[model samples]
Target chain A: MTTLSAGKRLKSAVCSTEIMVIAAPDGDVEITCGGSPMGDGATNGGAVDPGHAEGTAIGKRYVNADGSLEVLCVKAGEGSLAADGDALAVKDAKKLPKTD
Target chain B: MLLEMAADAFGDRVAFVDPVADSSITYAELLAAARTAAQAVHDSGAERLAMLDVSNLAIPVGLFAAGWADVPYVPLNYRLTEAEIDALLERITPAYLVTDLTHMTAFGDRQGVALTSRGDFLGMARGGGGDEDYRSMDPEAVGVLLFTSGTTGAPKAAVLRHKHLVSYIFNSVEFGAADEHDAALVCVPPYHVAGIGAVLSSVYSGRRVVQLANFSPEAWIEIARTEKITTAFVVPTMLARIVHALEGQESAHMPHLQSLSYGGGKMPLAVIERAMQLFSDTDFTNAYGLTETSSTITVLGPDEHRAAAGSEDEAVRRRLQSAGVPLPGIEIEVRNDEGKALPTGERGEIYVRGDQVSGEYEGRGSTVGADGWFPTRDAGYLDEEGYLFLEGRADDVIVRGGENMSPGEIEDVLLEHGAVEDAAVVGVPSVEWGEAVVSAVVLKATATQTELQDWVKQHLRSSRVPERIEFWQELPYNETGKLLRRVVKERLDSA
Candidate 1:
């Protein structure tokens, strides 16, 4: 297995977060608490962003948050705001942790 | 380069066979046609030409004509829009655009051959499009300007020479062992190197080529069984679909298959093993090469696959993952960021240098390093046995928090999920970590993102598990059958 450096550890630590995410339409979201910062590392490459990021004090609407998240972006960066609403609908919100 | 040598040595032998139309051409005839085309092109005062329609008959003829005429021929994908073709025409500014009336719109005013007039050429052409007596041309000189499939960005042209194609044929034949009696089936498109290679290799080996106008699972099986195909090159997805199609049907479609070669993207070990089981008698070779090198540089032969695979030995398993040793004439090296060669088993970028190496074309895509070696963006390590193992593309590598993540590694695990049909793992921007490992999956059965996440978390370190999972009916792919990671992500961002 490959070794992870301290900096990578810190990066992974930041990326590995538990948070209650409400998926929003237009890839925009409103984080009630901790989550990855908007535009912190988002790129045009079309890769899925690891919801793991260091959250700052403020929350801004990064995506359009048109109330379109099928599964509440319960975990920041864990998934796309645009998801199969039905697949996520099966989950119970109370079972999710408030902060990761 | 090898083609010329072969032509010189085997001029009168039948070189190309259009199995679809039941026609064949001798090496001498092909050389003569190319020569004639070269003279015609030279007389036409076209220093540079653009070939828009890539029917098998037109491709080799155009290539040889340009070479014989001492001009460069730019190959354009037939799928490109007129505007895109116009833009390319503007960049190359060729004196002529070689195509038939069907695609005449692509060249508003450029001179071309009315393919309707090329009857013999059409019949002799592998897939059978235009029927014209195409001029034969030279063996030497730069020929093709193929564009890269723009999955990441705008497509850029990759310069290809006759030598590149010939050299690949020379090297691959030992592993493939195609002979005059072999009837090879070609289903890949001709615009790309893989497609071009399939056609050229068949011709070079004097084998019969049965062309599939387009790849449909049913059509492939039909053609293979009907034509008694002996060898073929296929992409992973094509293989998967074929396997899926033949799942319960015990048929003779694969009975005549002597060998199966695959590349253009990574294939899961399970997929390959499954293929082995399906075609137990046929030899399997996993090839690894880019368009720049014509087709393949390294191939894992069936023998090595069986010996090194699932040995329960780390060293043996590592060999199984390798792309195999460099071909006889190709030079390969693994280097650090500085371009200095590294010791065996050290991960670094792959660089290839040899007769087969085609320089970057039209100043597009990545630049060649200071040394002549073309920087393969792919990260891999050369082992003590001289085998090369691929990790993934450098751009595709994910650095989550601080740890480097190979999406391929994670993807291999996800492929184990019985419900997963296909999966693409990519890095998304993260404010907290440098990058996040994100996965988009297409499945045979339905599942939620949470379920997938939990499943992945169980198999991998939490750092390697995707922070997000999206389900799609299908993943976007380009013309050459490579997944379009950027397009898939765009759907997510827009969603």
Candidate 2:
């Protein structure tokens, strides 16, 4: 688990000896947990700017085929489970069926 | 001159190390290779040559060869389309094109061959007449023809001379404090003046340069760590990549990293602060200049950063936001519409005159006035202390009821908001206000245009607030990642 924070914390991740998260895009999508809204180079755009949070499992939902939204995040141990907009939150992600 | 100097002093010392393949060329070997290449090209009956490759060992070799052969070298932008290349070829009408024969199909019978195809480059030089001895001649003799980024309109070639290149290297050391031991990692495209400047500075100083054929986040970290890179000349976009790459790591691998130089666009204060935090020991030098000027004319050193943070004086704080003080040989003056120099602390066009500045573009009317000062088209002011602060481009300034409003100031304020990801402000024609302030922003949170407008109104004056606000997924920017104000305005006009 990486400890990520915003602004100064974001910079601290860059130069300091502190462990920081290096997020790579899985295409035009991203997944995050225990990461600050000040996530380095994360795209958060829409009417409501969903602020990122630490320990709050969050993942991006890209517009998909059949005009549906597919969220790319792990639920329980299911590894990269997909859900609609309603199941996008961390709590919903946890409540979904576990694979193991 | 620098190559000759290096050959004389360093001799067998490693002059260039190709980071891509881990190959190197010693100074003595490089001199021989360049001589051989020059002979081969001269033997081929070509009077001039165009190099189409990216940054690598061959660039310097080709440059020296061209110089020794007394032929002009034209560098083609890799980003430009085939049509653009064809157009450039038509304009310059070169006698030969020298690039790696590996990519022979890319040129398609235009010109050139491998340096080894004839014979071992250095060994082949034995019997041929020695390279034509050439002294640096008139400053107007074209050394390179660089094309401007066509963000506003069609691209035009800016004729660069040997004197212009010499001026850049001398002033860069004066401003950037570069040295022979300094290792600079260049991430910008080699086609651009900044990229070329990085290569030239390294060669001129005889320093080790780690050339990135292409920029990758992982590669940047690895290079900085393994090479003990002391300097990184980057665009803001590249810096963003570095920041992103360091996200989950305990610490950046660039412990030996000293300076991160930025230009090509206005860096948001948030970005600067974050970069400073990431590399606590590393200095951030905010540089501002244009390709026409070679590279940098002003640099805001790291020391001023702490001063700006400590002082409450608006002037001191504002210095942090300005373009920065003029480099040693360059003099900048703020002039009014009439071209009369403005008093200190007044806003006007930024005019620069110096030995480092370039002459007028070839076959083009003088951009520099009769007085030898180039009207930079950048709207800025000279503070009482002689620090130069840039507002925006003169064309970007929105004149409403005679008040000069800088969109950059508004954009900076918007970026300060936590919800804002990227912001751009441009002027749109208005029926009532003569010109309306329109803002296009990419937000991190869900917010209405009203919310963003209200946010701006709360922080800025009523007149400065945008008349209309629009949200975009991303802002339109040039290849250098500079926000395109003209495009934004055009989008608004079409909308």
Best by lDDT: 2
Q: Relative to the unseen true structure, what is the C-alpha lDDT of residue B3 in candidate 1, on a scale of 0 to 100?
A: 38
lDDT of 1 by residue, B121-194 (tens): 33343332222442233333566777777666677788776556545654454212345567777777767677
Query: How would you encode candidate 2's per-residue C-alpha lDDT over B1-495 as one tens digit per residue?
Result: 546546655556666677876777766677777776777777777656566666777777767777666667667776677777766666655455644435434554544322232123334543344454534333445566677776667677776666677666654542112355667777777667787677666665566777877788788888888888888877777777788778765556577787777887877666666677788788777788887787788878778765775578977876667667777678899999899999997888899987657746657855877788999888888777788777788878887766778887788788878889888888887887788888888888887887778888899888888878888888887667687888888897788
* TM-score of the first chain in candidate 1 relative to the native first chain: 0.19
What does candidate 2 score on TM?
Answer: 0.75
DockQ of 1: 0.01
lDDT of 1: 0.61
Residue-level lDDT for A57 in candidate 1: 11
**Segments in model 1 whose C-alpha atoms lie over 4 Å from true places:** A1-100, B1-14, B17-24, B101-140, B162-178, B250-253, B308-322, B340-346, B363-366, B445-448
- State the C-alpha lDDT per candidate: 0.61, 0.64
Candidate with the greatest TM-score versus the true structure: 2
Off by over 4 Å in 2: A1-100, B43-47, B100-106, B110-140, B174-181, B248-250, B309-314, B401-403
Worst 10 residues of 2 chain A by lDDT: A91-100
- Write candidate 1's Cα lDDT for A36-87 as tens digits: 2322232333333444213321111122223344221212333332222221
Tell me the interface RMSD of every candidate, in Å: 25.8, 25.8
